[model samples]
Target: MKLTTKGRYAVTAMLDLALHHKGEPVSLAEISERQDISLSYLEQLFAKLRKAGLVVSMRGPGGGYQLCSDPKEIAIADIIAAVDEHVDATRCGGLGDCQDNRRCLTHDLWTDLSNQIRVFLSGITLADMTERADVRQTAARQVKRLEMVADSAR
Candidate 1:
Protein backbone atom coordinates (compact mmCIF):
# COMPACT_ATOMS: atom_id res chain seq x y z
CA MET A 1 0.00 0.00 0.00
CA LYS A 2 1.18 3.47 -0.79
CA LEU A 3 1.38 5.90 2.14
CA THR A 4 0.91 9.55 1.39
CA THR A 5 3.42 12.19 2.40
CA LYS A 6 1.17 13.28 5.23
CA GLY A 7 1.15 9.85 6.84
CA ARG A 8 4.88 9.31 6.32
CA TYR A 9 5.79 12.71 7.68
CA ALA A 10 3.55 12.32 10.69
CA VAL A 11 5.20 9.05 11.64
CA THR A 12 8.71 10.47 11.14
CA ALA A 13 7.86 13.50 13.24
CA MET A 14 6.41 11.34 15.98
CA LEU A 15 9.42 9.00 15.93
CA ASP A 16 11.73 11.99 16.23
CA LEU A 17 9.86 13.07 19.31
CA ALA A 18 9.94 9.60 20.81
CA LEU A 19 13.67 9.15 20.22
CA HIS A 20 14.74 12.57 21.38
CA HIS A 21 12.22 13.71 23.95
CA LYS A 22 12.04 10.53 26.01
CA GLY A 23 8.70 11.61 27.54
CA GLU A 24 9.79 15.20 27.89
CA PRO A 25 8.14 18.01 25.98
CA VAL A 26 9.90 18.98 22.75
CA SER A 27 9.25 21.95 20.57
CA LEU A 28 8.00 21.64 17.02
CA ALA A 29 11.06 23.39 15.69
CA GLU A 30 13.31 20.68 17.05
CA ILE A 31 11.29 17.90 15.49
CA SER A 32 10.96 19.79 12.23
CA GLU A 33 14.65 20.52 12.00
CA ARG A 34 15.68 17.01 12.87
CA GLN A 35 13.17 15.30 10.59
CA ASP A 36 13.52 17.85 7.77
CA ILE A 37 9.80 18.46 7.72
CA SER A 38 8.42 21.97 7.55
CA LEU A 39 7.25 23.49 10.82
CA SER A 40 3.95 24.44 9.26
CA TYR A 41 3.31 20.92 8.06
CA LEU A 42 4.15 19.51 11.48
CA GLU A 43 1.69 21.91 13.06
CA GLN A 44 -1.05 20.71 10.77
CA LEU A 45 -0.31 17.02 11.33
CA PHE A 46 0.05 17.47 15.07
CA ALA A 47 -3.34 19.13 15.25
CA LYS A 48 -4.97 15.99 13.92
CA LEU A 49 -2.84 13.76 16.12
CA ARG A 50 -3.71 15.84 19.17
CA LYS A 51 -7.42 15.79 18.41
CA ALA A 52 -7.20 12.03 18.06
CA GLY A 53 -5.54 11.85 21.53
CA LEU A 54 -2.35 10.36 20.05
CA VAL A 55 -0.44 13.46 21.09
CA VAL A 56 -0.80 16.55 23.25
CA SER A 57 0.46 20.08 22.76
CA MET A 58 1.43 22.74 25.23
CA ARG A 59 1.77 26.47 24.85
CA GLY A 60 4.48 28.83 26.08
CA PRO A 61 8.26 28.86 25.92
CA GLY A 62 9.82 25.40 26.23
CA GLY A 63 6.41 23.94 25.49
CA GLY A 64 5.55 22.15 22.26
CA TYR A 65 4.25 18.60 21.93
CA GLN A 66 4.38 15.27 23.65
CA LEU A 67 2.81 11.91 23.11
CA CYS A 68 -0.35 11.25 25.11
CA SER A 69 0.65 7.62 25.59
CA ASP A 70 3.83 5.62 25.54
CA PRO A 71 5.39 5.04 22.15
CA LYS A 72 5.12 1.35 22.86
CA GLU A 73 1.37 1.75 22.98
CA ILE A 74 1.02 3.59 19.69
CA ALA A 75 0.72 1.64 16.49
CA ILE A 76 1.49 2.67 12.91
CA ALA A 77 -2.12 1.94 12.13
CA ASP A 78 -3.23 4.44 14.75
CA ILE A 79 -1.18 7.19 13.13
CA ILE A 80 -2.35 6.25 9.64
CA ALA A 81 -5.98 6.09 10.69
CA ALA A 82 -5.65 9.38 12.53
CA VAL A 83 -4.55 10.88 9.24
CA ASP A 84 -7.51 9.24 7.42
CA GLU A 85 -5.19 7.10 5.29
CA HIS A 86 -6.67 4.28 3.25
CA VAL A 87 -4.54 1.30 2.18
CA ASP A 88 -6.55 0.16 -0.77
CA ALA A 89 -3.94 -1.11 -3.23
CA THR A 90 -6.66 -1.05 -5.83
CA ARG A 91 -8.80 1.99 -6.44
CA CYS A 92 -12.60 1.64 -6.55
CA GLY A 93 -12.65 0.60 -2.88
CA GLY A 94 -12.02 -3.00 -3.87
CA LEU A 95 -14.76 -3.33 -6.49
CA GLY A 96 -18.47 -2.66 -5.97
CA ASP A 97 -20.32 -4.35 -3.17
CA CYS A 98 -21.93 -7.74 -3.83
CA GLN A 99 -25.37 -6.33 -3.14
CA ASP A 100 -24.77 -3.97 -6.05
CA ASN A 101 -24.49 -7.11 -8.18
CA ARG A 102 -21.28 -5.78 -9.64
CA ARG A 103 -18.86 -7.47 -7.32
CA CYS A 104 -15.54 -8.04 -9.00
CA LEU A 105 -14.39 -11.66 -9.06
CA THR A 106 -11.22 -10.58 -7.24
CA HIS A 107 -13.09 -8.57 -4.65
CA ASP A 108 -12.69 -11.09 -1.87
CA LEU A 109 -8.96 -11.43 -2.55
CA TRP A 110 -8.46 -7.70 -2.38
CA THR A 111 -10.61 -7.42 0.72
CA ASP A 112 -8.68 -10.17 2.45
CA LEU A 113 -5.36 -8.58 1.53
CA SER A 114 -6.61 -5.24 2.85
CA ASN A 115 -7.67 -6.85 6.10
CA GLN A 116 -4.30 -8.57 6.47
CA ILE A 117 -2.46 -5.34 5.89
CA ARG A 118 -4.55 -3.58 8.49
CA VAL A 119 -4.02 -6.36 10.99
CA PHE A 120 -0.27 -6.40 10.37
CA LEU A 121 0.00 -2.67 10.85
CA SER A 122 -2.12 -2.61 13.99
CA GLY A 123 -0.26 -5.52 15.49
CA ILE A 124 3.01 -3.62 15.41
CA THR A 125 3.73 -0.82 17.86
CA LEU A 126 6.30 1.93 17.65
CA ALA A 127 8.29 -0.04 20.21
CA ASP A 128 8.24 -2.95 17.82
CA MET A 129 9.66 -0.67 15.18
CA THR A 130 12.55 0.20 17.43
CA GLU A 131 13.30 -3.48 17.85
CA ARG A 132 13.20 -3.92 14.13
CA ALA A 133 15.70 -1.12 13.78
CA ASP A 134 18.03 -2.96 16.10
CA VAL A 135 17.62 -6.12 14.08
CA ARG A 136 18.47 -4.25 10.90
CA GLN A 137 21.61 -2.87 12.44
CA THR A 138 22.70 -6.35 13.49
CA ALA A 139 22.10 -7.67 10.00
CA ALA A 140 24.07 -4.81 8.50
CA ARG A 141 27.00 -5.52 10.74
CA GLN A 142 26.93 -9.19 9.80
CA VAL A 143 26.85 -8.33 6.13
CA LYS A 144 29.80 -5.98 6.54
CA ARG A 145 31.79 -8.66 8.28
CA LEU A 146 31.06 -11.17 5.55
CA GLU A 147 32.03 -8.67 2.90
CA MET A 148 35.31 -7.97 4.68
CA VAL A 149 36.07 -11.69 4.84
CA ALA A 150 35.33 -12.06 1.15
CA ASP A 151 37.62 -9.15 0.33
CA SER A 152 40.41 -10.73 2.37
CA ALA A 153 40.05 -14.00 0.42
CA ARG A 154 40.22 -12.17 -2.92
Candidate 2:
Protein backbone atom coordinates (compact mmCIF):
# COMPACT_ATOMS: atom_id res chain seq x y z
CA MET A 1 0.00 0.00 0.00
CA LYS A 2 1.07 3.62 -0.59
CA LEU A 3 0.05 4.98 2.76
CA THR A 4 2.47 7.84 3.16
CA THR A 5 3.48 9.82 6.23
CA LYS A 6 0.58 12.18 5.66
CA GLY A 7 -1.98 9.43 6.14
CA ARG A 8 -0.13 7.83 9.01
CA TYR A 9 0.41 11.08 10.85
CA ALA A 10 -3.20 12.17 10.35
CA VAL A 11 -4.43 8.94 11.89
CA THR A 12 -1.93 9.20 14.72
CA ALA A 13 -2.85 12.77 15.51
CA MET A 14 -6.58 11.98 15.34
CA LEU A 15 -6.06 9.04 17.66
CA ASP A 16 -4.17 11.30 20.04
CA LEU A 17 -7.06 13.73 20.00
CA ALA A 18 -9.54 10.94 20.56
CA LEU A 19 -7.59 9.66 23.51
CA HIS A 20 -7.20 13.01 25.26
CA HIS A 21 -10.27 15.01 24.24
CA LYS A 22 -12.27 14.68 27.44
CA GLY A 23 -14.81 17.45 26.85
CA GLU A 24 -11.94 19.82 26.17
CA PRO A 25 -9.97 20.71 23.11
CA VAL A 26 -6.55 19.09 22.66
CA SER A 27 -3.78 21.28 21.37
CA LEU A 28 -1.77 20.44 18.29
CA ALA A 29 1.39 21.25 20.24
CA GLU A 30 0.52 18.57 22.76
CA ILE A 31 -0.26 16.11 20.01
CA SER A 32 2.99 16.99 18.28
CA GLU A 33 4.98 16.45 21.46
CA ARG A 34 3.30 13.16 22.19
CA GLN A 35 3.27 11.78 18.67
CA ASP A 36 6.57 13.29 17.45
CA ILE A 37 4.75 14.91 14.56
CA SER A 38 5.50 18.45 13.42
CA LEU A 39 3.11 21.16 14.57
CA SER A 40 3.07 22.89 11.19
CA TYR A 41 2.26 19.64 9.44
CA LEU A 42 -0.50 19.00 11.92
CA GLU A 43 -1.86 22.46 11.23
CA GLN A 44 -2.14 21.64 7.53
CA LEU A 45 -3.75 18.27 8.24
CA PHE A 46 -6.21 19.76 10.71
CA ALA A 47 -7.27 22.44 8.31
CA LYS A 48 -8.38 19.71 5.96
CA LEU A 49 -9.88 17.73 8.82
CA ARG A 50 -11.93 20.71 9.94
CA LYS A 51 -13.08 21.31 6.41
CA ALA A 52 -14.15 17.66 6.19
CA GLY A 53 -16.18 18.12 9.40
CA LEU A 54 -14.25 15.49 11.29
CA VAL A 55 -13.04 17.97 13.87
CA VAL A 56 -13.85 21.43 15.15
CA SER A 57 -11.40 24.04 16.37
CA MET A 58 -11.74 26.35 19.32
CA ARG A 59 -10.17 29.74 19.77
CA GLY A 60 -8.94 31.81 22.79
CA PRO A 61 -7.42 30.62 26.00
CA GLY A 62 -7.27 26.83 26.36
CA GLY A 63 -8.23 26.69 22.71
CA GLY A 64 -7.43 23.79 20.43
CA TYR A 65 -9.34 21.11 18.55
CA GLN A 66 -12.01 18.54 19.31
CA LEU A 67 -13.73 15.77 17.44
CA CYS A 68 -17.05 16.67 15.89
CA SER A 69 -18.69 13.46 17.09
CA ASP A 70 -18.00 10.45 19.24
CA PRO A 71 -14.80 8.59 18.47
CA LYS A 72 -16.79 5.48 17.65
CA GLU A 73 -18.58 7.41 14.94
CA ILE A 74 -15.33 8.48 13.25
CA ALA A 75 -13.82 5.87 11.01
CA ILE A 76 -10.08 5.63 10.34
CA ALA A 77 -10.85 5.72 6.66
CA ASP A 78 -12.66 8.99 7.13
CA ILE A 79 -9.69 10.50 8.89
CA ILE A 80 -7.37 9.43 6.11
CA ALA A 81 -9.73 10.76 3.51
CA ALA A 82 -10.12 14.01 5.41
CA VAL A 83 -6.37 14.58 4.95
CA ASP A 84 -6.60 13.79 1.23
CA GLU A 85 -4.78 10.52 1.70
CA HIS A 86 -5.70 7.50 -0.33
CA VAL A 87 -5.37 3.91 0.76
CA ASP A 88 -4.46 2.66 -2.66
CA ALA A 89 -2.29 -0.40 -3.08
CA THR A 90 -2.29 -0.13 -6.84
CA ARG A 91 0.50 1.48 -8.81
CA CYS A 92 -2.05 3.18 -11.00
CA GLY A 93 -4.18 4.27 -8.06
CA GLY A 94 -6.99 2.01 -9.22
CA LEU A 95 -7.13 3.83 -12.51
CA GLY A 96 -6.38 0.68 -14.47
CA ASP A 97 -3.55 2.31 -16.40
CA CYS A 98 -0.66 0.56 -14.75
CA GLN A 99 1.06 -0.33 -18.04
CA ASP A 100 1.09 2.32 -20.78
CA ASN A 101 -2.56 3.29 -20.26
CA ARG A 102 -3.63 -0.33 -20.13
CA ARG A 103 -4.47 -2.57 -17.22
CA CYS A 104 -1.47 -4.51 -16.06
CA LEU A 105 -1.61 -8.26 -15.46
CA THR A 106 -1.67 -7.79 -11.65
CA HIS A 107 -3.90 -4.71 -11.74
CA ASP A 108 -6.95 -6.64 -10.59
CA LEU A 109 -5.07 -8.13 -7.68
CA TRP A 110 -3.85 -4.74 -6.53
CA THR A 111 -7.26 -3.15 -6.98
CA ASP A 112 -8.83 -5.87 -4.86
CA LEU A 113 -6.17 -5.38 -2.24
CA SER A 114 -6.80 -1.66 -2.19
CA ASN A 115 -10.53 -2.22 -1.75
CA GLN A 116 -9.89 -4.66 1.07
CA ILE A 117 -7.60 -2.16 2.79
CA ARG A 118 -10.21 0.56 2.47
CA VAL A 119 -12.90 -1.69 3.92
CA PHE A 120 -10.65 -2.74 6.78
CA LEU A 121 -9.83 0.85 7.68
CA SER A 122 -13.48 1.89 7.35
CA GLY A 123 -14.48 -0.80 9.83
CA ILE A 124 -12.12 0.56 12.46
CA THR A 125 -12.97 3.65 14.48
CA LEU A 126 -10.94 5.84 16.80
CA ALA A 127 -12.91 4.42 19.72
CA ASP A 128 -11.99 0.91 18.69
CA MET A 129 -8.31 1.84 18.65
CA THR A 130 -8.60 3.65 21.97
CA GLU A 131 -10.06 0.51 23.50
CA ARG A 132 -6.94 -1.47 22.82
CA ALA A 133 -4.88 -2.14 25.94
CA ASP A 134 -1.61 -1.77 24.07
CA VAL A 135 -2.68 1.62 22.77
CA ARG A 136 -3.50 2.78 26.28
CA GLN A 137 -0.18 1.46 27.51
CA THR A 138 1.71 3.28 24.82
CA ALA A 139 -0.13 6.51 25.49
CA ALA A 140 0.57 6.25 29.18
CA ARG A 141 4.21 5.75 28.40
CA GLN A 142 4.29 8.79 26.18
CA VAL A 143 2.76 10.90 28.93
CA LYS A 144 5.22 9.60 31.47
CA ARG A 145 8.13 10.28 29.18
CA LEU A 146 6.95 13.82 28.63
CA GLU A 147 6.65 14.30 32.35
CA MET A 148 10.17 13.07 32.82
CA VAL A 149 11.42 15.47 30.20
CA ALA A 150 9.63 18.33 31.86
CA ASP A 151 11.03 17.41 35.22
CA SER A 152 14.54 17.32 33.84
CA ALA A 153 14.08 20.68 32.15
CA ARG A 154 12.87 22.30 35.34
Q: Highest lDDT: which candidate?
A: 2
- Candidate 1 Cα errors over 4 Å, as ranges: 94-101, 134-154
The lDDT values for all models are 0.78, 0.95
Q: What digit string (tens of lDDT, one per residue) describes model 2 on residues 72-151?
A: 99999999999989888888878889999999999999889988999999999999999999999999999999999999
- Could you tell me which residue pairs clash in candidate 2? none
| TM per candidate | 0.78, 0.98
lDDT of 1: 0.78
